[model samples]
Target: MKAIVKLVILLFCVTAFSQGQQHVEYKKVSNNLIKATYYFADNSNAIQSEGFFNDKNQLQGMWVSYDTEGNKTIIAYYDKGKKVGVWTYFKDDKINFVTYKDNKLIGVEEKALVVN
Candidate 1:
């Protein structure tokens, strides 16, 4: 029926538009670092993750991740491929701060998410 055909067409269009191609970009920066950026597949092409890597392809420096809604989800750091410094995690109703030293968890703190 025409109604059925229209429904199918609508579904197809919605599916096609909802799907987007994900991509990543890597660029060499000063101090022998490779900056990497990952983008979400949604039509908005929002950033999903970003970080840096050393010349040896080891994770280094600051890294960040975002959710599909472009909200910061995690903030982390590394030193010579070893986890170090404080990392922040954003949850649905709370925030967590985790500290690391030489890739070992040192401390953790959690706080409620407050909205004005």
Candidate 2:
């Protein structure tokens, strides 16, 4: 009985600790812009990313992917953040684009358009 009680206590503590972690929040800056804040899941310092959202808060443009050091690796755009024009991929020679409507991709072309 004592062992079972101890195990229950341990499990409760673990669950509480886990729940205290995983922090994420988003704030609307305007009708079309939102700032998403992320935490380390351990309640550490938060990092922020800006996203463009439609009237329905659907993502339109976002900084997707990150470098090894956490720098933004891709700047993807959307009519709302739906991936409309060229998504500039940082690192190496890669370029991609996606066309979308209502947050659905209608067309995608990758590594095709290059700028000199």
Candidate 3:
């Protein structure tokens, strides 16, 4: 029963997220770089996420993601497509912070939401 409940909640979250899926937009920044942004189809046209890519089309710099209501949900840092530094994930009631290096998680901090 516990597993079934968890599955249901997971499915609900996935469905809700897919309903507001963002269409990615890519703009050439140079000979070998691109700036990417995502937009939802709800007519608001707000940026749902944005990031930068390097010459090899690998993610670099800071990548930020926003919820359907334009609330920031995540901020991740990458170096040449490898996850690095501390990544923060937000929700209404909880926050998860994880540190990574070379795409491997090195540390984590889970805390209650502090910012309203």
Q: For each candidate, what TM-score against the reference?
A: 0.76, 0.52, 0.71
lDDT score at residue 51, model 2, on the 0-100 scale: 53
Model 1 lDDT at residue 6:
100
Q: Measured by TM-score, how close is model 3 to the native structure?
A: 0.71
Q: For candidate 1, what is the TM-score? A: 0.76
Q: Write the per-residue lDDT of candidate 3 for residues 23-99, one digit (tens) a residue.
A: 77889878867999988656447878999999998999899999878899999999999999999999789999999
Top lDDT hit: 1
Rank by TM-score, highest first: 1, 3, 2
Clashing pairs in 2: 60-80, 60-81, 61-81, 78-82
In angstroms, how far off is 3's CA in candidate 3?
44
Candidate 1 lDDT tens digits, 9-107: 999998898685578899989778999999987644789999999988999999999998889999999999999999999999999999999999999
Best first by lDDT, ranked: 1, 3, 2
Mark the regions of model 1 whose C-alpha exceeds 4 Å error after superposition: 1-22, 42-44
Model 2 weakest lDDT span, ten residues long? 42-51
Once superposed on the true structure, which residue ranges of model 3 sit more than 4 Å away at CA? 1-22, 30-32, 41-44
Count of backbone clashes, every candidate in sequence: 0, 4, 0
Of 1 and 3, the candidate ranking higher by TM-score: 1
